[model samples]
Target: MGLTQFSFGALVRTRWAYALRGSQHESLLNTAYALEAAIDEIVFIFGPILAAFLATSVHPVSQLFVPTLACGIGGAVFFSLKNTVPPVLEPIDVVAAEIPDAQSNAVTGQPAPALQTAGDHAAPTPSPEDNGFRLRRLHRPYSAKPRNVLTYRGILPLLVVFVVFNMSFTAFDVSMTATMKAAGAERFLGLQLAMFAVGSCIGAVIFGSREMKGSHWRHMVMFLTLLTVGYVVFRMVMGNFLILGVMEILTGLCVSPLFATGNLIVKDIVPARSLTEGLSWVTTAGSVGTSFGSTIAGAVLDASSPHMSMMIPWIVTLCAVPLALLGWFLARKRPGRGTGRATNTAA
Candidate 1:
């Protein structure tokens, strides 16, 4: 059959996969995919050894068949289901307003309501700031909208806590990899990485599905605690390859829900006008934290024994506890923790 004839079937399959697992599963799926990649890397490292052993055997062609079939079948399955599905909105009475006099609306309007912009859509105009505070008088659209008059005094401090916790997390990825290599656990490194990604996928599936939507902060707090425990576990048992991998995986798994729920919290407390800008700052900060983590881990590893280097990452991660606490405190102040109400159009 022609490619066109099979296109609908492909779309149906993609939609089904995405439906059974929400788009959030896309991140979890990536975790599983990274495990598969780790497996591939392992195979690449071992292939030459196998080839040399088989060289003197009776049938060398047998090896070629397995690799070929594996590649072909995997490719066929993935490509057959490579289709993008649009978001299905559950009927929502999204409030819309009429623009009275273009110039009047431009002068007095607030930032336009968050909407999915297409290629033709224009970016919103920049807000005018006065003495560091954006002036509400200059933006008519935002000023006209119904102001949500709710304040949770505790939320600001919590944002700081979340930021600190993230800095610690950023350290883990760099430190763990180098420490494992330094400790002569290099042979099992591939397996360790595989487990890390697989565990994260499991975590994402657990939280991304039904368990997270209602009252997620309680669960989120529990997850953060798990992350702390996981780090401590690593600190206690540095040389044991198996235990290190398990701890890393556990730590990695706890992170996804924290991230997803944190984004939810940011949408709730901040002014609606600053939502996008706030998220961008959060992302940029996390990136910076990771970069610092790499540097810190590298410096520690270079200075002392392999064991000492491994301990530093764990220490840094533990210090980041304040940030997690701050995030939790802020989240507590905000109502509907992870209920998804505040997240509407936030993404």
Candidate 2:
């Protein structure tokens, strides 16, 4: 599952870069992200309900096959669309002038031609031989050297913010479940979760349609602070179902926008050559946070009360604000490190 998700994420990022490549890239990317988030939440809203129905009406293990079948069909359709594939961009360092004609022919096991120079001191323009050499180099089977995406400034702190933010969201889920079960209203758990997804879908649509301006760091700080406040409200109203449901929807309003902002940050900081890997790292961080959050929240719920479990998310989210501020400071200190405007030729 991890491998599959990683591949899918990389492909999605590559496609987005290819399709949205112009002056309006930022706005179009935002809309694409919003649509993606909305569709994802819609799937989440239905997937669990369907799984529950299958578990109750059919065999205990039948629910698993639904996702397997869906993935198979979806993968088939997605991969079959050949036109959507992005062009492979080679590094600009391997120019025609760099490799001599003789060495290039030798690498390809072909006979070498006589060398021609413009003059002793004049700069030699690319000849037919040089062009051939460049073509061969472009078509060669050699892979470019791998670059470490984490070495980029501000990326680590941005990822840390995501990790903690996702941990809080996942913990909120466990706390919600604990609260519902303790209240003897476990059947409405699906409804409550669906409300959160619905709210997120709405938020994604609204946020995506707008042309947001200003620093992404400030956007993140604002969203995180708002979400933290929502969680606090969640803890306060856990005992009241109606009020809790309202709070759940309100809190969810920040979820998709926050995720979209994080992806934008990654896109801004990481070089185009490493964009896919950088985005995949964000997905991986979210997965890790989800796993840890659920485990910790479950343990806390078992040992204490739902309110205590809820506190974990509230406090975690509160801590994320300072981390985001730190990221902003670090990014400002380094002028061109993650400016996103400069084109990096190095892979």
Deviation in angstroms for 40 in model 1? 18
Task: Provide the lDDT at 145 for model 1.
Answer: 45
Writing each residue's lDDT as its tens digit, candidate 2 over 1-347 gives 64654367556765776577656564588677767778778897899999999988998989999988988898888888787677666544455445446777788897755446655455556576555454545443326675688987778888898888888877988998888998899999999878888888888898889867777777888989999999899888888988888887888888888888777777777767678788888888887878888889999988998889999888888888999888877765655644344321121
Poorly placed runs, candidate 1 (over 4 Å): 1-163, 183-188, 213-218, 271-273, 327-347
Each prediction's RMSD to truth: 15.3, 7.9
Candidate 2 Cα RMSD (Å): 7.9
- lDDT winner among the candidates? 2
Provide the lowest-lDDT 10-residue window in model 2.
338-347
Give Cα-based local distance difference scores for all models.
Answer: 0.52, 0.78
Worst 10 residues of 1 by lDDT: 1-10
273 in model 1: Cα distance from truth in Å?
4.9
88-155 per-residue lDDT for model 1 (tens digits): 43333333343344465478775433444686367664333311233333343434544332244334
